[model samples]
Target: VMGLIFAKLWSLFCNQEHKVIIVGLDNAGKTTILYQFLMNEVVHTSPTIGSNVEEIVVKNTHFLMWDIGGQESLRSSWNTYYSNTEFIILVVDSIDRERLAITKEELYRMLAHEDLRKAAVLIFANKQDMKGCMTAAEISKYLTLSSIKDHPWHIQSCCALTGEGLCQGLEWMTSRIGVR
Candidate 1:
């Protein structure tokens, strides 16, 4: 009886489904990343006004994926939902060099939040299929990822249009969340 009780308690306290929040500037391919992971197809693109939530299960792990809008106005509303998130996926347009700094600032602000300090982060340098796109290393440098070097995360490159590198990003994220 004691053995069974201990097993039940251990199960209860073991790693649970991790909640992941996906955010980025408008047209950064946040939704496309999610769609590609879920449906394995790139859907029509549009700005996500508020947010889109999806539950994805792989193996024994479940992921509550929240794709949040990237508009400045929408950011105020984003704080409310960050409370329970265990991980974050930030997408950036690889071709938009001009706005890269702005994107970095926004992401920095989000990571500075006390509630999110411990959360794992995965940055998706999306739109790699486009010409003149920046590489993951360049995006990491521009975003000053080294500042958060102590934080647990990885910045991955991806081409959501053709689904290149999408699975690799997902696997990296899931691994960090103890989802293996």
Candidate 2:
């Protein structure tokens, strides 16, 4: 019995890997967050027309994350990447107040989709360092996170450019991975 527990832990810590998809509206900083996890440094980025894939290890769990493009034209392709995804990282521009409604709409749409039904959600209220930016609580309210009952969800305030609050968010992800 003790051997079985050891084997389980070994498999989980050494071999287990999760699929995560980073998505959001165009210019919401998804790529920046992805790079922050990988290199721990901000990368100069332009609008993503396709997707970026990378492996990231946090708290001993391996996560193969895909940072997908968020332009209106590319949003339709998001579903193709949802099949094996265990986590959906939604990066929102905290200062982009005018687009909050659109972001909320996209979030609910993904949550309702059959492919993503089982995935946990992490909403990053990014750009927190800027003045007049929405707080994490405010973004949660705007996105109606309380209305979501089917999946585990969390909202974290972060400054992707500066790589702040990013670790705490990932720590939450790694913690969730062990619960089930």
Candidate 3:
């Protein structure tokens, strides 16, 4: 159809495509955030066993987002997709104070991979709606983000359940990608 042809042409002309991966420990709300971005509504999600991928368009830019399972057992598979990724969205359960150290360890290990050296990282300090949740600054400090000299990094507070701050995070990411 003519409409389909125009759509493809528009994509070819003005669409900027980027690959991004979402990662975090199990129960960190990665899937919830993805659904929020896609549907603009809260979605109930189960633990991801492997991965779920979706394409999103924001500000006329196209993004291929991969939501990978974050269980300890699936961590090893993360590196497999790092090579082509332009950005990494690391989710954290801001109220899980007890697991901050574990999250830090896993995050550092992921950053150390050679393929991720140039990828921009956006850490989502999720669950800000909960009581006693850590602020973005606190999470950044605990994650030792200052030491991440290899890539451009940022931390944003978000509550996936309520869809607060999700668009701002994506806007930051698109800016980092050099797309207007």
Candidate 4:
């Protein structure tokens, strides 16, 4: 009985531990989304030069999330954080149609990395509240999300400022965690 109690306590204490990384182009609202998840409110933020990290708990699951800087020069350093990440949240600027290709390039590059082979991807089609933004389906097509056969992935339309659609995205994440 004592051993069973200890095992249950340990699982409860650790929960579904995961190392999650959020990455995208600069101005894609990665920080805002992180703040929304952390505080459920918008937090004023500037361009992240390196990364912003926080512990987020959802559905009793605990995970360390790293919101990496998305500037062009900072993109090369993203791999340094990939060691044990189990989930990848790729935020897309739904309104920046011009940069969708670049986003695709980065997504493909990250997915191609050996360290990320098993990481499940969560693509946030952010800025849904903006006018003239692309739809999630369109963005998915442009990003060729369908071609990714090795890793599990999902795309969610969201407005980080209002925290809309974020719950659904997180639900998918937690469910994925449960499966693992």
Model 4 lDDT per residue over 96-163, tens place: 99999999999999999999999999999999999999999999998889999999999999999999
- Give the Cα lDDT of each candidate: 0.84, 0.93, 0.90, 0.94
Best by lDDT: 4
TM-score of each: 0.89, 0.93, 0.90, 0.95
Q: How accurate locally is residue 158 in candidate 4, as Cα lDDT from 0 to 100? A: 98
Candidate 3: which stretches are off by over 4 Å? 1-13
Candidate 3 residue-wise lDDT at 35:
93
In terms of lDDT, which candidate is stronger, 1 or 2? 2
Worst 10 residues of 1 by lDDT: 171-180
Candidate with more favorable, higher lDDT: 1 or 4? 4
Over 33-57, each residue of candidate 2 has an lDDT whose tens digit, in order, gives 9999999999999999899999998
Pick out the ten consecutive residues of candidate 3 with the lowest summed lDDT. Answer: 171-180
lDDT of 4 at 63: 78
The predicted structure with the larger lDDT, 2 or 4, is 4
Higher-TM-score candidate of 2 and 4 = 4
